[model samples]
Target: MIPLTEEQQMLQAMVRRMAREKLKPRAAEIDNTGEFPWDIVELFRENGLFGIHFPEEYGGSGGGVVDLCLAVEEVAQGCSDAAVILAGQALGSKLILLSGSEEQKRKYLPRIASGEFIPAFALTEPGAGSDNVSMQSRAVRDGDYYVINGRKIFITHADVADIFTLFAKTDPEKKARGISAFIINKGTPGLGIGKIEKKMAHKGNHACEVILEDVRVPRENLVGAEGEGFMEAMKILTTSRPVTAARAVGLAQVALDEAVAYAKTRVQFGQPIAKFQGIQFMLADMAIKVEAARQLVYNAAFLADRDYKSKEAQRASSMAKCFATDTAMQVTCDAVQVFGGYGYMREYPVERLMREAKVTQIVEGTNQVQRVVIARALLED
Candidate 1:
């Protein structure tokens, strides 16, 4: 348990109240209808939830990564999908803050902080996922602009995002070094939104393919140096991983809470199931794992707030993301077991949580990638 500042604590309390009073009541409807949570987004904006981590000069609250994670965890407790709306905003804006020039930041970061802009990150393509080196997207320098041509898949918030932080290959023969990042507005010429994927979990969370057919972007929109996109992405992931871990922890805690609450009232053999040692043991294990994961996530976020580019921070983020999300999958499954048959039913929140837990392992660079990162860091040291 890391001690939060008074301001952070107050922010957490406000988010928790919002989650319980607002998001929890709508979680089921959002899942069932598969509709974007625009109302929730409006709520967050009204409450000054966007861009909380950027500098105050940029219209942000002068907070840090830890502040972002604290808000995410509380929001996730009530609606896991809704939490993504907040975390995803950070994911979309991270590159700009880390690698964008002063002119770029001054132009965009303030809009982000003011909730006047909704951003999406476009990186993954049909041919490139974990192996970003295999990217096929091309960006040819034209007169005063770069013409980009490629298709980006699994782009979160793409359909509705006001702007995109996109990546393309500026010098194909250079492979990874060839990659370049850009900031392209949504309505840019030759930019098109493709099929919207109906995900297994996080149902209403919007993600789709973004097609760039000779999209022309101003040279000024290039983020950082032309050949530094890959490194910039790595830096973004270093901080973003812990945010995902915090989401995993929050979801796991909700599962544990639901399981414990159900166990106490569920009657079996003329007694409450919580009275049985088997159920008690499961509850205890779930509680332990969730707490442990939470601590790791908090520690990772703290390290990120202190230093975003250090090797230590990268390693911690990878470890925390890997362990916490894995814990989420295990704890959510056990939560279902605690509910017995009812757990499998849609009427119970544990079943939904179980499904949600599975995706955390797959997203944010996958647990497998995290282990590779952790191993390489360990071996290098």
Candidate 2:
């Protein structure tokens, strides 16, 4: 079992209450409209939810990973849409804080932590997913500025981002190591956002392609040492995935909760479905997996918060992310089965829950890459 600090518990309880009061009722509408829940995002900002895990000097609550995990889980339990918005802000901000200079942090951190601004990570391209070294986007040096040319696809919250934490290749000869991280405002010259794409789950979270053509950013905009972009990206992903795993656990819990409630109420063969051995077994399995995934996620989060430098953290994170999201998919699919035809209807929340589970496996790095990570860890050991 994982233990939370008193502060973490308090934050968790507060966010849990907020989730039930604000997010649960609106989930269906958000899913139906496929509209980004900018209002809920605004609500989070107003309540200081976005910056809770940042340093106090940066207008944050002086919180930590435990606080962030609890917050995200609570939000996801109410609505994955809101949880993702929280994750995008917190995780994207973390990149800047870890690597950005004093001025960059001062410029972005205060507003980011205060929800006065939103940030995004732009890395994946139409030609790159797990094999990101294959990306052809280039950043050429020109008169104390970098002229960036690239198109990043599947960027989360691209439509509403304020500052983009992006990656472009600085030296192709170094392969992935030659990549560099940059911060560019949304309205920079030659920067453009594509139309938002329709998605299966996480519908309320808008994603679009970001294009950069001859965009110029000051050399000071670089994050960390040049040619360290891929390394920093890996570090950020490692630290962030465990929180995402927490969200997946919450997704599984909601699925299990809905399935249990339905089984206890729906009658079949002159008795409640809960009485059937089949329904009983499915619920038990879901509960078991949910517990395991939650434990892994929390443990990983604990390890990461202890200044664990980050490769092992990445391993544990991928393990948790892969296991928890796969569990969510299975449990939510079973939930749909438990609800029977009613589950298939648009009115049932479980249908949306089911759709949401699919994306968890795909994003935050795919399960296929998770397997590769696991394999590499063993070989290295």
RMSD of each: 0.9, 1.1
Q: Please report how far candidate 1 places residue 10 from its true position, in Å.
A: 0.6
lDDT digits (tens) for residues 331-368 of candidate 2: 88999999999999888888888888888888878999
Best model number under lDDT: 1
Error of 2 at 220 (Å): 1.0
For model 1, residues 137-189, the per-residue Cα lDDT tens digits are: 89999999999999999999998899999999999888888899999998999
Q: Which residue runs of candidate 1 sit more than 4 Å off their true CA positions? A: none
Please give each candidate's TM-score: 0.99, 0.98
Candidate lDDT (C-alpha), each? 0.91, 0.88
Clashes of each: 0, 0
TM-score result, candidate 1? 0.99
Give Cα distance to truth, residue 110, candidate 1, Å: 1.6
Deviation (Å) of 308 in candidate 2: 4.0
